[model samples]
Target: MLGLRILVHSIKLVVRNWRVALRISSPLIAVLLVFGVFMRGSIAGVATLGPDEGVSWLAIGVYLIAQTFSGTWVAVAWHRYVLQEDDSGAIIPSFMGRRVGAYFMQGVLIAIIVGIVTVVAAAALFFAFSGLNSLVLAIVLPLVIALVGLWLFYRVSPALPAVAIEEALSIGDAWRATRPYSGSILVLVIAMAAASGVFGALVELTVESSTYLYLVLVMVQTWISMMVGISVLTTIYGVVVENRDF
Candidate 1:
């Protein structure tokens, strides 16, 4: 199947670029691990039941977007730095720190913009569905919004690396370079998201009876989910670097 092929190729690419992949992903993993420790209680609270649960989930969604943007920026910079070991002797961080910094700032800006967009979109949807049955809209709206948001995210996903490695600030350039394999990249993202969702659900199901178990499970699941996302990004970046000279 096509999915199998994607998986196999993704694995191969990761292996081929193991050094670069790990170099990029290791620091990111550490950062996310620390971040999760700090944010676990808050994120877990988002999953609990109440009239405010929907709002809490939406907030968690926005937080996810922010973390994704931050991590993606750093991932790109680290990958670039590793790939440049041949010619520049790993001078990506040294020579391109300013560009990386700019992209980091841009990532923050993108996170804020995404947060605002999510909030506005949620508000509009909430109002629009005011007359609809809560049960139906609850299921439908979240999926619809998540899919749309992910698509939009995929559109600008490569911008960080474009800025970090290529020194290009314009998102337009990133889109162009990423265009050739957008479909594949999006597939990977969706698969990773679905897998993480399933894993989280399983964890929640297993830990439902005990608060301590729930907290532990949630923290572990969150870390694994994030690691998987970063791993996929690392694989994609490796492919990109191999195919293009960047």
Candidate 2:
């Protein structure tokens, strides 16, 4: 249950330091809000559709790029604020261009690794399940495949916060560090997936009620998700890498 303990503790880190978390993320939140308006429909499960935010391909592209920058910046800043407790105390977190670039690079590397692993896992699982052809299997197979990916991602995600803190850690290194926590991580992956799916469905029901409310809920969810995600990586890095106790 180490992973569950870590998840709960990580959440407390964000909640206890909620003000600083907001300060670290607020600038990027503003940036995302501005560019987010132009994004239409759901982009990776979070809805961005709005009253006048029509379908613009160019706007979507720009918004995605802006989102990347803003996300990286906030993640790096938050890691520092959590680990280093940086003393600037400014309204917005300090900008670190090189760290942001490095963070993006590491993210792309992780994505590629995760993508390949997921694809291979999918192919294998598809072959394994192909002969069954039951309706229940059809519904459950994708969930199983997705859990595989999430499990793998959690195993190596320590690399992300390492990059944020200017530490060098390869995917292989992170994978090795997390070896003992395999069972816990799998349980954590399942719990996280279930929670996210339930929350996303709850928010999706609001889409037709009021566009503004939908937009607000979606952004708020994204904001909290991002912070909690960063905290998770930070927690993992602290526990397995730095040998810090919660």
State TM-scores per candidate. 0.58, 0.90
User: lDDT: which candidate is best?
Assistant: 2
Best by TM-score: 2
CA displacement after TM-score superposition, residue 120 of candidate 2 (Å): 0.9
Total clashing residue pairs per candidate? 0, 0
Among residues 3 or more apart in sequence or in different chains, the pairs in candidate 2 whose N, CA or C atoms overlap within 3 Å are none
Please estimate how well model 1 matches the true structure, expressed as its whole-model Cα lDDT: 0.55
User: Per-residue alpha-carbon lDDT of model 2 for 92-209, expressed as tens digits?
Assistant: 8889999889989988988898989899988898887788858747788888888998899889988888888888889899999999888988988887777778988998899789
Where does candidate 2 stray beyond 4 Å? 36-53, 134-137
Worst 10 residues of 1 by lDDT: 86-95
* Model 1 ranges with Cα > 4 A deviation: 1-78, 81-100, 112-134, 179-186, 208-220, 234-246
Candidate RMSDs in order: 6.7, 2.7
What is the total number of backbone clashes in candidate 2? Answer: 0
